[model samples]
Target: MQATSRNFKDNAHRALEDANLQKAMGFVRTGFIDKRKAAADALPEFEALRDAARDIKNHTLANLDRYLERYEAKATETGAQVHWCTTAEDARETILEICRSVGARTATKGKSMIAEEIGLNDFLERNGITPIETDLGEYIIQLRKEPPSHIIAPAVHVTQDQVEADFRSHHKALPADRSLAEPQQLVAEAREMLRQKYLDADVGITGANFLVAETGTSVIVTNEGNGDLTQILPKIHIVIASIEKVIPTLEDLGVILRVLARSATGQEMSAYTTLSTGPKRPDDPDGPEQYHVVILDNGRSAMLGTEYQEMLRCIRCGACMNHCPVYHAVGGHAYGWVYVGPMGAVLTPSLIGVDQAGHLPNASTFCGRCESVCPMRIPLPKMMRHWREREFERHLNPPAWRWGLKAWAFLARRPRLYQALTGLQVRLMGLAGRRRGRFASLPLAGGWTEHRDFPAPQGRTFQQLWAERKRAA
Candidate 1:
């Protein structure tokens, strides 16, 4: 919601000083990455699955219109109402219409980035409806009156202590002296509080993990059973998903599902993979009376013909951020948007204006780990570089970096000057290192040496060494 990423240094400084935050981040760093690694090791055909998944996504994007129409037809035929919203405004209007038609007062929502993108909860609240978050992570952040910091783990920065405080402060019925020490206690408290809300709520909203066109089913994978309760018990069920989530077949969904769990939290599979199609049948025991799937475009279709088309393949795995050196140092809040890390760098600029979010692309170290671990195998670095190019062309690049590139380009065009400049650099480093084999501080490089000392450059330039060896031969 901030529109721009904050400085990495400032965000990191805040994170380090907060004891609770440090504990929470430490848990995330260890748990998610380790689980994913073990899961990947167990799957012998993981690489093959990755390749197949990439093809499935690419194929879907290429023939998106066809799949969308087919999906709508099949979903409608099964008694589900499918609404296509081309922009944020259109999506908001469609949802409002549904809410008004149902006379919905209280809404229970599962975690949906697409809903976040469209600002659905705020709209509902403004229209005199109370919408509650059912996901544990989302519930914590919502109670604290904060937006999500990470895409997958919304409250990854919140420690157990923070959760206890939030529940104590918000839940009036909770005991005054209750020692809410562990996760189980916290979960139990929330579950007890929300049990009545689900049965009482008029409508439920959920995001789709995958929309199977073959069966007109919208699949959602959740660790908790909250999504099921959110959809089934309520009289009205609303699924807010992007149009891109559709897959042609369950087999295709299986390929993506294989990589999704392994890439997301390193689980063989999530605890629940629920596939729902429309409202409950008359013969059905208990289910929603109405079902509506709001398929939102919100600039995603625009990315199809562009260089960033590959980014649409993302399954929201969060692997890129898990392995990013910069993200490890700074955490999600630094990216200052709905999405974060490498995928965010490419997406923020596109979703928001390039100028507004151009700084995000520059935040990466161009480390290849993100792409390597990406379940979708999206060319993240290449996409980020494209954002960088967009920034450069529009003159959004900082004057210092722009000037440095210009200077480097000028010298690079002249081999003699370039070699001379390199010779001077090497000689200066040698002279500087001679005193103590290192320099604690450097002239323009002080920031680099602030936390880490620069490794001294080699004494001779490569060109000089090559020339001398040629003469000797």
Candidate 2:
């Protein structure tokens, strides 16, 4: 919805202080990270698949225009209307127009970040059309009236107790004394509640994980079967996706699929991997009557040839966020955007501009966990560094930060001076903290020292030790 990347520091601070958030974040470490690692380890060709996936995306992006035309021709031939939108506003209005024309009262939605990016729900509501989120995670956040905290696991920030409360609060018709202590119970309750919404929906909307040009198919992979129900039961089905999602062939999709689920949720394949080519054929048993594909570019076309183009390779796996230390500490809402963590840090700036999202790139510690786990092998750290450089160059950073960088740059250019200054500072700090072997508080490092002590430099500077080792060798 609204861009709050500018308030990331404040958001992060609030998140860190939240006990429920801290408890929920435990799942990221204990569940996702370990499961993903095990899943990757089980696959003999996982790394190779990642490389292939990256190459497939690169090829698709390079010939994106050609593939888009091919996709349109094939989809149109298959009785699907393909709408190309250059902006979020255009995409929102187009979906609304389709709904209005059909006299739609409500639409069922699968988990779609593209819809969030375009503010589709609010737009539809304001236009007198109800948008119902059917994906479990999406439905949870919808009930809470909050944006998704994570891309794949939208309600990951929500705990079991909180969810039980939300269900009790929202499902007023349901018995209050029912036992909702378990996750299965919660799922069953939500499933029963949403099943009616699916049946009553006039249109179904979903986001494509991959758009196949050769077959003119839109694909969605989900552990829950909500996406399948969302698209099939409604009279009309609409696939909303960004331009970067288009791939040239089914073979390429096959390669990417080998890595997407493993990297995202540690499954060989999600329980339901649904592909819709077009509206129902005459012989089809059950399907939508109308099929529409809305491809929104937003600002992705501008990133095609730039250094940031590597970011387009992202599969929205959520691996980077799962492995991210910063995300683990404060959770996803701290990013203040639809996308979160390393991918969001780079992509948000591109979509929403670096000025509003300047703090996102700076939020990282650049430990490179994100790049290490990325299925597409996107160099998230490098892209974030580029954003930081852009921020500095554009003078978008605060004066204190600009001055600090300038001061560091001045000394960095001179080898001897840099070494001498650092050596002196290290010696002074080393002596000062020799007794404790750490500093609980430091002049300009309050942020670091606030949580834990800054370890004291042991003795000589690292350069001195390196020089001695080099000479000995």
Worst 10 residues of 1 by lDDT: 1-10
Q: Look at candidate 1 and tell me the lDDT of residue 389.
A: 85
Local accuracy of candidate 1 as per-residue lDDT tens digits, 297-334: 88898898999989899999899888887776667777
Give a tens-digit lDDT track for model 2, residues 341-393. Answer: 99999999999999999999999999999999999999999999999999988
Off by over 4 Å in 1: 6-20, 434-440, 446-452, 458-473
Off by over 4 Å in 2: none
TM-score for model 2?
Answer: 0.98
Judged by whole-model lDDT over C-alpha atoms, candidate 2 comes out at 0.93
Each prediction's RMSD over C-alphas, in Å, is 2.6, 1.1
What does candidate 1 score on TM? 0.93
The lDDT leader among the candidates is 2
Clashing pairs in 2: none
